[model samples]
Target: MLPVAAQQNLPVATAQTQNIKRIPLQRFEVPGTAYETVIGIAEIGPNVSIGRHTHPGPESGYVIEGGFELLVEGEPPRMLKAGESYKISPHTIHDAKTGADGAKVIATYVVEKGQPLAAAVK
Candidate 1:
């Protein structure tokens, strides 16, 4: 994930905000283990939200840019900004919401091989 400070360097945007984009960066199998590692960047457009979802395994993430409110099921929502990192347990449902400017995050998942990275929550 890129940081919001980096976004400030870009040209100003129009009134309308952009949508969330998930760009996979890399993936590799963990030798001697049943897990694989997947790394990707999530570009959350301003005023947008990624609906509630759950990972096949644990998720380790870093906020590189902008800011967002993380709504983890059964927990109070919290605001996270650049330079911060977070961990989500396997199968925990959660959602991410952004302010007017949006946020960028880089995340890594250590999941069972051949399983989908994430599943949508009802």
Candidate 2:
């Protein structure tokens, strides 16, 4: 895992309103180790997808550019436009897709130490 300082030293979104904003990134702690955090860029790319996956803990994300829709178990597809955000609890099965024009978002993942980025479901 990357060090927190190293991650912080890198350049990232810093705006606080409108087009850009700097928000608190969430981190998940393991039973007996340091926490893990998912740092996201404002506008990643168009049609970007992370595939169906699982989280060891909880995850949260906010749209920053364009828009996208999400489908989680027991829920309907939710359209999240720029400035919108959502959170997923640990072990939730889900997948994400970028908007037609592409979308950018800031996502914070709380995962246990040594957890896979995501566990693909069959």
Candidate 3:
């Protein structure tokens, strides 16, 4: 395990740092069919409606700059604010939209090797 000091000094990694480009949500996906973690900063648009999708594995995220409303299948949508964190389990259906002023969220996705980061579902 990394020492507490080392962990504290570590910087947050983003999708760009992982070599993934900032594509539109509609075009979001792991390029080249290679499954690997891609951490990125996302600016959640206000009142944005994300189509239904499923994560191939787990997706962990935190609100960094703004607030949002998150909805996971079988649960009611909930509001999340800055500094809040949540995790989407493997194969879980979910979607999210920004709050009134929009939000910036840092997301880290742990996907299965060779699987797409998100698979569109209905």
Candidate 4:
């Protein structure tokens, strides 16, 4: 186990961390495919920033409350407000930073089974 101080600085979605709560809702295998679908809710505290990362496949999400700035490599940042939805292609590096009100989002990912759900990008 990591020391309390180190744990406190972990990446937003890594194991667990301050300012962000990731709740895994479900994971199921896709019929006739080698991929699986994962659903979860990400609650980000005010001013929290989730660094760039990527999944083995695609990730789609809906803003459930408040909003954030979605930054993807080579693209302009997009502000996703409540009630909006967005999708990122496989392995596309991206990150999100919440505004003062923070944000809550439900995300769905279609990824290869047995692979890490997310990987931080340099």
Candidate 5:
């Protein structure tokens, strides 16, 4: 058996840093409707592009770190840095690319029941 002092000196397990971390914050179902509100955070890696995608509902997000280049259908691309925010309409095609130092964002969405949070745009 290991001594108590020896056990106390052992390395502790810790969560490793990752390129991206999606943390769900909250979810609320609309009363008597097929809709729900979801909130979460997205941590992106440096120089990463999330790729073109669409949501089944409206989405709003605020930049928390570094910056992002956002491209949405029918509009010119825009750069959003920390403390900045954006809103995306339902079914609007868009893509988010992170800057050199990477980025973190807090996002919220009002979506339909059973639909995916995001769908890739072909």
Candidate 6:
């Protein structure tokens, strides 16, 4: 489980209406390695746009409710609805916006030990 401070430090969409609720589920450290896998669920508000950001490692998520518009650098923007899933490569700058009905997703990340999960991008 991530500490409260760490969870609070996670970035959220810029809009006041936008917010991210991260429910840390599990974490596993790789033996003899500096990598750790973290799992969590994220709830995004309706019509919210999570600001552009990059992760310290790869991330994957499955939409559990509603839909989202996802844009990753160098790739065409795409829409993912409930039951759909997406993967983001390490350090890939990306952004997401919830659809009219908002969205919820279960996300898992394989990240470096002692590194912040995400960093905002300009």
TM-scores of the candidates are 0.82, 0.66, 0.68, 0.86, 0.82, 0.88
lDDT scores for all predictions?
Answer: 0.75, 0.60, 0.61, 0.77, 0.74, 0.80
Backbone clashes counted, model 4: 0
Q: What lDDT does candidate 3 reach at residue 89?
A: 91
lDDT of 1 at 76: 92
- Pairs that clash in candidate 6: none
Top TM-score model: 6
Displacement of the residue 18 alpha carbon in candidate 5, Å: 5.9
lDDT of model 2 at position 39: 58
**Candidate 4 TM-score, true structure as reference:** 0.86
Give lDDT tens digits, candidate 4, residues 58-113.
Answer: 88999999999999888999999999999999988888889999999988888787
Tens digits of per-residue lDDT for model 6, 12-75:
6445423666676888897899998888887777888887888889989999999999999999
In terms of lDDT, which candidate is stronger, 5 or 6?
A: 6
Clash pairs, candidate 4, are none
Off by over 4 Å in 3: 1-35
4 against 5, candidate with superior lDDT: 4
Which residue runs does candidate 2 get wrong by more than 4 Å? Answer: 1-34, 42-49
Tens-place lDDT digits, model 5, residues 28-99? 898999998888787777877776777788989999889989999899999999999999999898887787
> What's the residue-level lDDT of 64 in candidate 6?
93
90: Cα error in model 2, Å: 0.9
How accurate locally is residue 5 in candidate 4, as Cα lDDT from 0 to 100? Answer: 19
Better of 2 and 5 by lDDT: 5
Candidate structures ordered by TM-score, highest first: 6, 4, 1, 5, 3, 2
Tens-digit lDDT track for model 1 on 1-122? 31232222222223322475567687889999999887878788888767677777898899999999988998999999999988889989887888987888998888898776777666
